[model samples]
Target chain A: MTGPLQQVLGKAAEFGGTALAKLQHTHVPGVGQASTTEPREVAAARWRAVTVFRDDLAGPFPELEALGPDLEVRMQPAPGDRGTELSARFHGTPTDEQVGELRAALRRTKQLAEVGEVLRVDPQPHGTRKATLQGAALEGAAARAPKEGVL
Target chain B: MKAAIWAGVNEVAVEEVDEPQLLNDHDVILKISKTVTCGSDLHLIGGYIPAMRAGDVLGHEFTGTVVERGKAVTKVQVGDRVVVPSFIACGHCWYCSQELYSLCDNGNPNPGITEGLWGQSPGGCFGYSHAMGGFAGSHAEYMRVPYADVGCFVVPDAVSDTRALFASDSVTTGWTGAHLGGTKPGDVVAVWGAGAVGQMAARAAILLGAEQVVVIDRLPERLAQVRQHIGAEAVDYSTTDVVAELRERTGGRGPDVCIEAVGMEAHSTGIQGAFDQVKQQLRLQTDRPSAVREAIRACRKGGSVFVLGVFAGPVDKFPLGAAMNKGLTVRGAQQHGQRYVPEILAHMESGALTTEHLATHTMPLSQAAEGYRIFKEKEDGCVRTVFEPGG
Candidate 1:
């Protein structure tokens, strides 16, 4: 029974991640992503970027560089002394999972360059999770959070 | 370890939970001394925020002794008594450099949830919700604090835990409103809602050299507290017209600054109140925002209005036209506690700021559910209930 439950939760976590990705692209009436719905190729073709606070950001950013040889990475000084703008995109259209990896890599690059260590929250503490479906879904959403966002 | 958990919507319970551990190089573990229920926590408790999961820990404002430290934590040592801001921020972020710690880009790990609701996400808050950060709250006996050197401030030796605890959220949040609302010397400031945050806002205005500060609230107990503890004039909005009264007191020019400390669930007496309640219940609007409406209407032309409240989403009848036509500089943000904690501690040390009055009830962690109950219902004049997790 425990094995089955774990398997179900694992699947739920995957679903949660996919749902979040869809949520970003989906248009809601009053609120949603700033961009309108676009072709998948158009969405994936755009460069994803985050600005690091260090003005002297010269990157051998291990996180983004690790993606592959096909990934195009760029760095430039941001305006008004904000710091460096680091951006990346694949040579061709990438899968949702690939986009998710890029997002996570960009965030980690910023964290590592600025704070020197990525912040962590898990293995902290919690009361008993009641094994409810919504609880599992939320757990899944949180697991995918490092990779999902406007960035 | 015993901690308060959000059992369900409008439900809280005390449960034995796993103790926290240092999860990162910059993290520190705290033996929580005192953790208090905040008005903002009510939104999470009532399912208004919609990100809270059952069994999630419930607290943000707390004072504690650092019991353990990670390698990267240097500013605070083990056994140092400290108060952490509700928001989690890495000191290295651009927003943190700008002293806008609440808008730190790296704080909220679960940005997708918030970015989906709000166009952009702010910093993470403890025990608020997963959308802010799934970080466990301070209600437990021991809790982990990330970015210790950035977020934790040592409580001054002269300040007791009870007095210093409010600095974690209320005083800092209030200071954010008064300071950013641009209250200058000789300015007349009007603060709506005399809850802990509202009272603190009014007090901050006074300390910032506001010529006159008035706090408006419907609750007699909170209003009286504003007068007695905060040393600010109190108005019973239930009994009087708030805008007219503020205008009258400000010599018909209206207040130079208006701060709305009442969040989504603002109370009003007449048709507007009924309409807001109905709309909220019917899911037509996510927030009530009656105090905001009043603040904008009452603010002097070209004056400033700052919202310190924790509103989740859009409200009906917002009076944006009044805000625009009046040329009001309207701004709102979560409390940037990191920017103001040092000054607040200094004020606390000097006995210039008194916050012990806000902790009207103190009890063991076992009573947190009941504590939240009395606080939410405003029963027995309970302003805030401080829970001693160690006890």
Candidate 2:
């Protein structure tokens, strides 16, 4: 464990025993009462990260080896998709924020590799693809918007 | 940049809008030279499509000089003349890999809308409607093309600007209809609507060695073009019972292939049209399938029914029973343009296809609204109205 996330969780554990002891039987607004103590498999899941890529986010699994020496980054085919899913078992459990940040980092790497940056639609060119709905366009209208252009 | 914005139903305006910047690696910006008004555009302008936003830039069929290209673009270079099809296809999707470019998975950025309606989304289109992936339109001084390598095709020097322009949408769409319909040697093909698409479909079938091609339309000029330019038979559906005439002409076997290039806003003669108009007015059926209706009934048993028309909503009385029981093969589609642009361009260069006569009027971009008005009203026998952005 390293950085502020490590320190925050460490300090909480030192003061309240285990991290789960700090927030036992927590109440979530919409989800109702949440069990602070989860099953062993669910607890083990916190340290793992799964990211789905629509376009090819995966190139080489270079980052997976950095988690630990014995950590085997299991590469598997994502269900019902052609994308590759990579998972790594960390040596130490990571905080929820750390897992989210890790997922975002993976996504950012994908954006850099595939699109050169996160793809943006703004500064939308005068003529590009449109993504809106109206009229009979919804029911059965084929792509016959109009000939506002000149040949 | 000044652009023709879809301000309201049947309304257009030349408004000063932001110059589109190259936003992606494979993007290209075109200094638009020419654009043409198409028959389908009338659906949006007349408010039949009803998806146009107040400030949406309208216009899609265009040919322009490439002014800039994104980092990943390699096929097209700056200063080259290029024509892009209206439909947007990302070359890497499973759908595109299968050569069904129109049904590209990544084409429509907002897939939920189309998914709810069609159960699956089609590829995006430029300057089409928001329902089409509302890319700003090509009616401006500059237009941006995403997946530039996939959609942009270079226009040969031999193909004149006017000739190359229709290749973007109208010609390609017509070509798609004919090509996908499997037009074969000695086939007797019947096409509905003698407009741009119909003309091209007839010509394509002729080129594909069809023995006879019959084009049906109400307009005299469009039918005249079918006879004179296309060298195909014309059926004045307004004067004759289209199904009966087609059957009689085809020696009771009907045409071997019936192509429906006329789209959602179809009209019929007499009582059927009256019934459709009433049903349409009451919001019961969004599509008037007279052209499609007649086409199915007119096609021979075991013949192929190719539908190149655009039907947005459901129709009440589709002749599915005839199609099913008669062993008629019904295939309708938006243009899978990426699959056909190469051959179509080759045809254009080889002089087998000449589309220059289709552009009946040309106006400066500043007067784009007037061009659309002429198109909407069909004044001056305007089959197509071209606009010059630099003018």
Candidate 3:
């Protein structure tokens, strides 16, 4: 049975995977090897994901509300576009819970991308593929969350 | 030679004041080479400081040559160029031995006051009031220096008279202000006032690694000097709203440290001005709370506000509640010359701190009255006026 912290991490990793896939298509410039042919759809999805994520994190998060207005979080292309980036600027006081969640999400996102490579099997059924992706995302998230009863 | 005698309120004359003769076993009689009129002297002349009389020789900060010394005086011999610390502290006293000479219990000549720290009758000062031990001041051609071995420091050969003269008081005071204020690397510091001490404080702040320094003052030339030469952001409090401007510049948090270098008699227009003047007249207000108010308002929460300026009377309406709410710390005292003078001299020797720029006027001691008038009026960019008493 997964705990609440695990559950949050799992959801965050799934978001990371979807965001990473879209990021690869819009950003990865090299031809053939692993490129998205449908540029318009990829761009639209990237925009939608970024907008949604930004809005979700923009409002007063009870954990980070005290860190003041200097708190800034944004998504950017990782230095070698193969990875995604999440940057946060903290100025004032912030709770331990807020800091922990932010760190966990960032770490889990990177782990999900690493595990996605192993599950890239060819011609799998769409339902099976979705399940595999969900399993990999859950495993990544679980690994990043702190142990139960520990910070 | 006659000395200018301070008889009463607005009454001073070049009268035949007694020439100082060595009284103590460790005393040295100095032929005053240069004696700069200080802002505090104005308070004495205006009859603000009680116990001042007709014959009180009046200058505290000066450099001179030791013309004569008692048999016990060994460290500084006759004819040596020396700069006297404002206070006469016995070298062997517990406080002087600890380098906290300003609080020396044995050094102060007055028996009524418990040390010279505060609220006590003034300790003995050169040319200050009778309450301050009635010691003759440096304003005359020749004056006596007690505790010559401890109170006088040898001026290094490398430092010029024009630059090194302020080492006696203003420069050391400024250094002490910034040092005690906890000025550190990458600190956003705002210094109030662009007078000699204020400029020195800004310079010290920069040397101590304040990443951003802001100097606030009314005079344009002083402000310009602070901006261009001292490398600080100059704010004209005359025109700009200082509290709001500082907040905006410091990301709505305000400076990490604010220094009230303006001292007791900062004349600003409006409600603050009325309060300051009233406080001065009342004698209940010693610390300039207006400057303190501005410093408190302009400091980031948990920052420090340093009061280097002199306050004569009691302080009314201190914002202790606001200071507590903000978790801010405030600390100030008279300069500890013994602690910092050697280091300041070292810096001067190394060419790191040059005070020549602050000395805007240099005249013979005969023109001392005019120099005082100009300094009081703060006219024509007169930041520091050095008087050559020998001339």
Best by DockQ: 1
The predicted structure with the larger TM-score, 1 or 3, is 1
TM-score computed on alpha carbons, candidate 2: 0.77
Displacement of the residue B53 alpha carbon in candidate 3, Å: 1.4
i-RMSD per candidate, Å: 1.3, 13.9, 42.4
Q: Over the full model, what C-alpha lDDT does candidate 1 score relative to the true structure?
A: 0.90
* lDDT tens digits by residue: candidate 2, B246-299: 888878899889999888778788998899989977867777788998988999
Give the runs in model 2 whose Cα sits over 4 Å from its true position.
A1-119, A125-151
TM-score of each: 0.97, 0.77, 0.68
For model 1 the local lDDT of residue B207 reads: 92
- List the RMSD of every prediction in angstroms: 1.7, 11.9, 29.0
Give every collision pair in model 3.
Answer: B57-B127, B58-B127, B127-B137, B284-B314, B285-B313, B285-B314, B285-B315, B286-B313, B286-B314, B286-B315
State which candidate, 1 or 2, has the greater DockQ.
1
**Model 2 Cα displacement at B100 (Å)?**
1.4
The candidate that achieves the highest TM-score relative to the unseen native structure: 1
Candidate 3 residues B34-98, lDDT tens each? 77777777777776655454445567888888999977688988988888878666554334545
* Backbone clashes in model 1, listed as residue pairs: none
